[model samples]
Target: MTQELSPCIRTVNVMRYVTPLREGGSMPAIVEADDDFMYVVKFRGAGQGIKALIAELIGGEIARALGLKIPEIVFANLDASLGRTEPDEEIQDLLKASVGLNLAVHYLSRAITYDPTVTTIEPLLASKVVWLDCLLTNVDRTARNTNMLMWNKELWLIDHGACLYFHHNWTNWEEQSKRPFVQVKDHVLLPQASELAAVDALFKPILTEERIRAIVGLVPSEWLTFNVENETAEERREVYIQFLLTRIANSAIFLNEAQHARQSLI
Candidate 1:
């Protein structure tokens, strides 16, 4: 339950566009960077827009704070000229528009996707992951689309852009924060979780206001350009921090919902 500042997200320059990952609606691509590291770059110009990137930053960082394994995230600088070399018009447009700051997740070499039938997770880890998805109200981590990776025999969380859905409708985020996360029932790890209350007790105290603020602070100012309810970008950032603080303060509301989900699954 101790609070500590997370390391600042590193910034890198994209050197080469390797290939596009066409699996998801948002066309994230595998790109090589100046640091000699490969990354899965999430372009700001994608249909999902910059809000998705913000959610990925905040949600992924929060997951990291909760002791879950995730690839290192970085701010990738993309030059517009890199798009002209691509033949595909779609990718060309994406790259051209994403000529500034983009989000990139460090690629895990030879990592396998998590398959429930083949992989058995420990109860504590399962409970923690389920708890995290619930807290973030992430609806994408269901059985059909388990956004998890198995690398080096360890479970790693990924693709958290679908979280923090309240941001999409920022008119009443305060009320939305207090609302129960009803999507917990569909979480892929719900059946495997054996200790929901224990997970709550362990994480609730650790995610203090200071820690949440630090996580939100990691989001770049350019990505916070969306004006919600006439609030400026800086004001919108504070609102995000407040929404998270409210949700954690009312953690029991979502915890009870998750415990019920676990009971039904068991």
Candidate 2:
């Protein structure tokens, strides 16, 4: 949460707006954050608000917590006044034409999708991305499709808001019971895990208790849920945080390494 939320800090010189994503891109204004920034604007779309946005920011942060590379979240001023060129018109109408600060994301192309089994010099990077997905309990990266971005053969991971065991809640009990410990492990990540063991090393210092708490705290409460029905926002957030923490703690053998790293810093 060390990120600054200043309105005048920077202006996103939106490049060509990407067409609304068929799957999950429709709601947000996925425009480049600024001329120098690589990420794009992620606005509150149709169902835009606390619960839905909470799913996005928090879910993405959780992925980063588990040693995955993800786009950084930046708060930006996206009022109707700031205009360069419509990145993609289809997604434009879906946006609130109002001028105001919106949740903007850093663009990550390497984390974009790529064809699996494609030859590359840094195939190990691909393995790391997959392993990161597993640690997050991400079931989205199945054989059906993988999200990746390639640069110099290095692969990046993206779009995990629907992951972290979400499908478990929506699936039938019998099917859910058949799920793997970490769905990513069920794929080809395990056999090639050693190839990217070093990637785990990078996360050790970043996953400390304090660091994790800050991230969990930075998650805007409204994003967690809209009508708590019975509980307050704080109560719901604590409950959600506790659940996420349990999942992170049980994810993998390397988790201890990240934990120990966090402890030493404390």
Candidate 3:
């Protein structure tokens, strides 16, 4: 696979420790940054580990490539000293451990959580979002936890730290790539997605190996250097690129599965 660089992801310095969003397991925080914007920061020291941040970078970028709406993703620079003022030991420890590069998602002001009853989505847009989630094996977009937000009357995707799950267990990831993502059935937008085949046709060609590699390339070496099953950091990065390439190559089976789900639901 070709290794070409994409536009560099912007990096920002965290200025203040805003309130922690405790609803989710990771306890991500809403903080103000040196850029004068508020961001929902996902720390590398979180229990989910750096691999989760890798997924966020790769998954969020791919969503953007597919013309889906997602908040701006940036590398958040945290200082260990920032934890000194916080009284909460948990947050203090988290801040200290994440004193380097972390993940920051631009916080959308006045954005409401997506409610199926309150808002309706265009069928084509819904299909595209569902297709992309399926391709990434994201199981976090279910009704109980639709990680989607509505801002300025447009739907925006978020919280992709739970995606690209195959990396959680690298063993036999090649075989896992071909497996159908059954979780697509529970996707909040699946019922409204009637054009699965069209979505497949439109996106399949766009997600070429080079494009996927470029997205993977956006991940920081620090995040990818974790020792996984004795594989070197570079080797682990290659594994991510290979897994995605395999998934794209075998997308027909996954697309068929999505179509079957849509047929049953719609």
Candidate 4:
């Protein structure tokens, strides 16, 4: 797949990527695109890294396809024409136009340590996060709660590069928790549960089993993996995939989708 991402988008010197982000940037990386803007970049990683990117791309698209409020983003490729280390003059100009030099982002985080604190993030807002994860089958966010960002009253969840129903082999979920997310039921999204369910209601339509299977099939091939002529590695990968799809498709609680559909054929 060709990963060249320049389509009338304002480009920037991604190499000049800043660090520590004045403590309030969306992510810690030297951003190549503005928050509201959309640009593409070649995802950096191989094997699992590539799989993670594919999962992210698919999950992000699926979330948006479900008519949910997703953080604006796109996949783009870095232009190597610029010297590997040289500043991307064009990118810098784009950044200059996109943001104010004196501008500071009000980071929505309460603390920085990896404490057991669940964060000051209100329970209600946290429900939307649960909804997002349920639909995406994100396993990264845990009760210990190290994967969220709160800005103002709005809660933005991140680190979904690890979701999309592939945390472990999904072949057998019968033993897993099938109980409803009662804890978060009264948390926040409950008020809009019907509406939220409707938003993701069409997922079954958009991501039919066949379609989901195609995505899963592309996992190993499309992901980044070093030269693995070893048969054992290939066998392990196959086993993992077999179980992965089995569990993800059959599980109901985490991968919950409304029974309603514009077209039915999940």
Highest lDDT model number: 1
Which candidate comes out best when scored by TM-score? 1
| TM-score for each predicted model, relative to the true structure | 0.96, 0.62, 0.95, 0.45
Model 4 stretches astray by more than 4 angstroms? 1-15, 20-28, 33-43, 46-48, 81-128, 143-146, 165-266
Q: Residue by residue across 1-266, what tens digits does model 1's lDDT show?
A: 23257658999999999999999788999999999999999999999989989999999999999889989999999997899899999999999989999999999999998999899899999999988888888999888999999999999999999999998988899999998899999988889888888999999888988889889988877678744345567887898899999988888999999888778877
Off by over 4 Å in 3: 1-5
How big is the positional error of residue 89 in model 4, measured in Å on the Cα after superposition? 22
- Candidate order (lDDT): 1, 3, 2, 4
Better of 2 and 3 by TM-score: 3
Question: What number of clashing residue pairs does each candidate have, in the order they appear?
Answer: 0, 21, 0, 17
Q: After superposition, how far is residue 4 of candidate 1 from its true place, in Å?
A: 4.5
lDDT of 2 at 175: 38
Q: Please provide the root mean square deviation of candidate 2 (C-alpha atoms, Å).
A: 8.2
How would the candidate models be sorted by TM-score, starting from the highest?
1, 3, 2, 4
Query: Candidate 4 residues 108-156, lDDT tens each?
Result: 3352432224445433333334455565556555544445554444444
Q: Write the per-residue lDDT of candidate 3 for residues 1-266, one digit (tens) a residue.
A: 21233746899999999899999788899999999999999998889978889989899999888888889999999987789999999999999888999998999999999998788888898889888888899999988999999999899999999999998887889888889999899999988888777988888888887787788888877678765446666788888888888888888888889889878886
Clash pairs for candidate 1: none
